[model samples]
Structures are given as C-alpha cells and as structure tokens.
Target: MSLDDIRGIPTIELPYETIPVTEASAGIQRILSLAYMLVWMQSENLITAQLFGRSPARQLIFLMDETEAHLHPRWQRSILPAILTVLKELELIIDIQLFITTHSPLVLASVEPLFDQEKDKLFLFELNDNQVTLNEITWAKQGDVIGWLTSEVFGLKQARSQEAEQAIEAAQAWMRKDDMNQFPENLRTKEKIHQQLLKLLPGHDPFFPRWIVRMEADD
Candidate 1:
C-alpha cells in the first residue's frame, strides 16, 4: 500500500509505523522534522534527569539539511534568535552541538550577528566545485554583525541604492493605468485592455512608486 495509507495505522501495531508519516510527506516534512527533533531532545533530557536525579550534562548533535527551504526570508531572519533562546534554555542543563546545511544567504546572514569575538566560536565554510574554503568572523556583540554583513561579507547594503526609487516609480505608474477600464460595458474587452495597459506600464509595483518619493520628502 501507499505511504499515506500506512500513516493512518497506529505506531504500536505496525512494524513500519516507527517512522513518522508526516516526515515522509514532502509538503510537511520540515514541520515533521522539527517535531521529531523536539520530541527526541526532550525524551533524552528526561532520561538523563531520571538517571542522575538531575539532568546530566549531555552534548547534542543536530543535523539539518536545507533548513530554510520551507521558510520565508523574513521568517528565516528569526532562526538564529530562536536557536540562541533554545541554547540558553538548554545550557542550564546540557550542552548542545548544532550542525546545519543551508543554501539560503539569509540563513547565513542571520547567524553572522551571533558570533562571539572573545570566544572565537564562529567559522564559515564556502564550498564550490568540490573545494572548500574556510573563513573566520569575529564580532564584539551580535548587533555588530548587521554592519559586517552590510559592509563586506554579503553587501546587503547595495540593495538600498537610489536606482530602486526610479524602478519603483515606473512600476507604480504602470499599475495605475492597468486599473482603468477602457471598455467598461464589455467585460472581456475591458479585461484585455487592462492586461495590455499592465504590459505597457511598469509591472513590478502594483501601486504608484511616486508615493515613496513623496514619503521620503516628508521624512
């Protein structure tokens, strides 16, 4: 039978039910992975506490592949902060060893802020054509990383250039034209005209870009 049919079976009865079906499904795999991670981590912590009458110091090795695949860029920004909180919480009882592989620049940028200069805890490795290069980054505090990323490492600051303003304005003008109905009586014709207007005008921004310039002046 297919995996979905198998997933409906309870874990205690079936031999193959030990693996979570939620993890097998591609759509919800990330969520399932996170769930399994939490469950196993907590279970281990519980066992350690019971054995020692208090949680014993234990090292955790966590491996994650393409960790940001299911996350939005904005949401990806929170990953490091969440990891820090988890580490802090676990530090009271156990030691943690985190290992992750990611293709997302945002994910890399997120961790840049967490580097400790005095501790010398941050190391970055870049791989290309089967060759790996290592780089060390040191920061006095987490906030210093934002400047580092904006400065040389990722060049995120270049995205703030003045050319983005012109592009935004052109896109807004196009959207305004698209909203007008040339033949309001004929739905199909009006739609065609609207589509044509959209194609002719800037398609990037649906709203007028001029508003941005005005806002800048007011500020």
Candidate 2:
C-alpha cells in the first residue's frame, strides 16, 4: 500500500479506498493504527533477519488497555476475535499472548463461545475490607450482557441509574419492616418511598408488581 501526505496528514491507500487516519471515526482509526503497527513490526523483523542473519522472534505479548474504548457495542463484540484471527494470519507471528482490560459486558459475552477453561483464566480485582485484592474468577457463560452486569464481576444490584437502585433499596427496607436508620429521612415512610419508586422506576419494572401486591395485602 502507498502512503500519501495530504495537508500534512498521512493517508493509507487500500485496495478499495484511501483513508486518512485523522478523518476516520475513533474506533476505525484505532483499528487501522493497530493493524499498521503490527504489519510494520513484521516487516522490520523480516528486514533484520535478511540483513544480519538474525533469528526472527517467535512470540509476541500484546497488552491492550480498555479494549472496548470508543467502539460501538457491535464492534466490541467482534474486536477480540478479530485481533486473534489477524495474528493467526500473520506469517511471522507463531504464538501470541494477549492481556486485555475491558468494562463492557458485551465484550465478555462475545468470548464465551471461544473461552477455553484449560487454556485461559479470568481475573477480578475486588475491594474487600478496604483493601484491593486480586482474585482469579471462574469463567461462566452469562446468557447475555445483562447477566454479566449483575454477575460477581460487575456486582450491580440492578442495571440502572443510581437513583433507581437507592429507591428500590429503600422500598425493600420499608416492605420488610426493617429499621430505616441508613435510608434517607424523606424516604423512610411507606408513602414517600412508594412515590420515589414511581418517580425513578419505569411502570413496567418488575419491582412494581411485588410492591403493589404487598401494599394491597397490607390494606
């Protein structure tokens, strides 16, 4: 491929189209830049081997931080697999070890089909007793992204706004006749908690039916 300097910005000429790295979307730019770097490394290794009779490297360790950054959910789902596929296709690279960090549940879900229990391990950094501890997490197939959000990895009580989670917690405390020392003073009463729930939660939220039925039963 050819490189052209247009207005001081480098552009790559591909078979189908020419793309200026600066003009492309953030996700596209990141992917293009990574691919270019890998190809350049391979070429450099080949030239070194030919010129100096040096042995080519056999293994590569790739460290990627926030693998899902700036990527759309669809792209996040495919990116990890795509990277592995590209490495396999590279003639010079024989083995690859990838260390990737991501907060997107979609990224985890995407790898479920490819995860090998014997070959791979998942790790979690957890806060315990005010100390940050690292633990090796067992890999399980969460049926979907939502499941991942609520799993031990994410530790979300509900996949929703902060207000909704608090409202639901207050409502539960009221329903169970528990002490309200930790809840907001304004939300301690049943009526006030119910109003807060109505304001924060959607009408179709599953919590509504249980709360409403309990209220009716109390009456």
Candidate 3:
C-alpha cells in the first residue's frame, strides 16, 4: 500500500468513525507511540528468525525517561500498571527488561502492588559533598501518592506549598520551644506565628489541633 494509505499509520476506531493516531490527544498519542514501538520490536524479532534464518532475540531492554511526563494524574496512577499488563499480554518469546524514570508519585504508588523485592530494585541519584552517587534503595511500599511524595524517594517534607511548609516548621519549633533565631523573624512569636498559620493552613489541616490546644492552654 502507498504511504498515504489507511494502513500506513496506526488508527483508533471510535463510535462514529476511525481517527488517525496523529489526531489523538497528547496523552493517547504518547501511549500509542509506546505500544507501537514495542509491537514493532516483537515483529522484528519474529521476522528475523523466520525470514532471515537468524535466531530470534533472546531479550529486549526498554528504557524510558520520565515516562509520566505528559500524562494526567489519573493516567499517571494507572499507566505503569497498564504497561506491565500489556507486557505480560505480549507474550513475547523473549525476556523483557524495563528501565523507567519518573517524577510523579502516582507512578511510583501505582507499582506498589506489583513491586518484587527480589526481581525489582529502586535506585536514587544523590549529590553529596560535591560528588554524585547512585544508591540502591531498599524497596518499601508507600500506601498512596502522599506517602510516596513524602517518602525518601521524593524527599518532600510536607507535600504542601512552600509557605505552608515554612509555617508548619515554625509552628513545630514554637511548640518545642526551640531557639527562635532559627526561624524567620515574623514566625518567631506565638501571635505572629499563629496569624501566619491561620493565613497559610486550612481549617481541616492536621496541624491546626496541635497548635490550637497549645494556644488555648497558654491563654
């Protein structure tokens, strides 16, 4: 068929009609692109063995960088699981190894159920004392996205805004009666810190009760 033929590029069938892969949304396009690449690899493996009288590939190594870059949070939560499912369904006659790097906590949380301590590993890139090091992290399951965000993998203190985090830290320091010099001048006093906390934290914030009880006791 000519390059412009309907079969030239992959298409998705919709309820009303078929649409070219190029017409799909960015998220869909990214997913379809990955599927096409893996399918092509499988096809090449089979073809080389049959037509060229060569041994089929014994393994495939797939490397993906920031795999969740363009994906929405909803998709990010499921994409890793879906990819693993697809890989299993492909049933290729070769072992497949996947190397993926992602910044999304949802991506890491999604794999919690599928993580194998024996077969899978987690590594962190750290900059220490002007030297860069790659450290192998012992895998531990963080129940949800928030857990992953605050876990060592992401190193987030509160998974909150910078202002809110600072306010919280200041509150914690005040409660512990720590040295006020360590905090911003505005956050050093109970009244000022309370106002800052009120402005930054929502009513339902967990930090509220702790601060409120202390404030009420001192009054």
TM-score of each: 0.46, 0.84, 0.89
lDDT of 3 by residue, 30-101 (tens): 888898898898887888889988888788787989878788899999999999898877655678888989
Error of 2 at 192 (Å): 1.3
Candidate 3, 128: how far from true, in Å? 3.0
The residue-by-residue lDDT of candidate 1 on 84-184, one tens digit each, is 67767866666666666665566666776565555535446767689997765444232443454564345464333334433333334434544333323
Q: Clashes per prediction? A: 1, 0, 0
Q: What is the lDDT of residue 95 in candidate 3?
A: 85
Report the lDDT of model 1 for residue 155.
Answer: 46
Q: How does model 1 score by TM-score?
A: 0.46
In terms of lDDT, model 3 sits at 0.87
Which wins on TM-score, candidate 1 or candidate 3? 3
User: Which parts of model 3 have CA positions greater than 4 angstroms off?
Assistant: 1-19
Worst 10 residues of 2 by lDDT: 1-10
Candidate 2 segments exceeding 4 Å error: 1-19, 91-93, 126-133
Decreasing TM-score order of the candidates = 3, 2, 1
The local distance difference test score of each candidate is: 0.54, 0.85, 0.87
Prediction 2 global C-alpha lDDT? 0.85
User: How high a TM-score does candidate 2 get?
Assistant: 0.84
